[model samples]
Target: MPPRTIKAAIQDALEDLPEKKLDKFRSALLDRREEPRVKMNSVEGKDYITIAQVLVSTFTEPRALRITLELLREIGCSEEAERLGELPHEPKRISVISISQSIFAHGPSAGASAGRYMSGDKHFVDKHRTALIQRVSTVPSLLDELLGRGVIKQEGYNTIMRTNQEKMKELYAGPLNACGPDEKDTFYHILNQLEPYLILELKSTK
Candidate 1:
């Protein structure tokens, strides 16, 4: 027999799950498919450039721009980062969490646009949920370090960490509480927003 496609495998597996779990899985799959697709080539390059322009124009503050650039780089948008870097600095206007959400929602990702369906294995879902929880649990310490290093002032650090906490709450209440296809992209974006700052902190310590 020929190898099964990922969607076929997921459909077969869903038959064995309980009704409630199956409903969640189905809903998640639908949401994932509904998301906008980007081609990631020259045609889509203009769209990404427009997004970069919005980020640069929307976030005028130095610190906000730096964090946004870090997130763009984290999510594999080097061109966007470079574009933001070239813009003239302006005053602060938006919150870190707002910028994070904008990038998570609008920014392009290879995995996001690949049109791949997630596995329906219970163990796989549980494993990813646990990992995301652990990663989110470290935000406090990470924010403290950023504050100590003067990378962000106390007010900014508090604001960003508060945003992180709210996201953690949502994750636990929704995706982590019950794994769904939509959760994978949501969790990955959260990590993308934080990982760069954590990496920078590590480098500063060395």
Candidate 2:
């Protein structure tokens, strides 16, 4: 109910996710929080589990999940987030091949929202549509954080953003932009060759 208590509960939930995915989740939440309707607790006075929580619960390292609840307390209080009933199901898991097929077969953005369906974070999707849209606006900042962390590269960012002026761009542009199969192969080939050279240099470090 109190902001301090609500913030603590959220921090705990996030600490449960994979370390790698943490920044993206936080960045999205920070952006999502700008909306007045994005209440931390549900109408029944329970804190909702975020999509990031499901992703962490499903894919993060064992130690990473351990860190989530604790971190949440450090950030906010859990008592404020306690809900009245059972949380929602985790999102479904899809193989890399399935994701590729879906993207290539359909289009980049096609069914991107389905990640919510597959993972356990469906509660947020079902309850907070506007908040999610606000969160989507934070993707570029999340990618920038990932670049700063060295988890992904400039080429990855470029590939990720080329068509990102809209949703689903992350899935489609690489193959769609290809002149043909051979050209696609050659383009990736060139990108692979120069990846290390494109390392993102942080301005603060300089």
Cα-based lDDT for every prediction = 0.39, 0.33
The local lDDT score (0 to 100) that residue 30 gets in candidate 2 is 41
Work out candidate 1's RMSD over C-alphas: 22.2
Question: What digit string (tens of lDDT, one per residue) describes model 2 on residues 32-76?
Answer: 322132233321222234543432443343222323332333345
lDDT agreement of model 2 with the native = 0.33
Q: Which candidate comes out best when scored by lDDT?
A: 1
Which candidate leads the pack in TM-score? 1
Q: Total backbone clashes of model 2? A: 18
Q: Could you tell me which 10 consecutive residues in candidate 2 have the lowest summed lDDT?
A: 196-205
What local lDDT does model 1 show for residue 148? 43
List ranges where model 2 is wrong by over 4 Å.
1-32, 37-88, 102-134, 137-206
Give candidate 1's total backbone clashes.
Answer: 0
TM-score of each: 0.23, 0.22
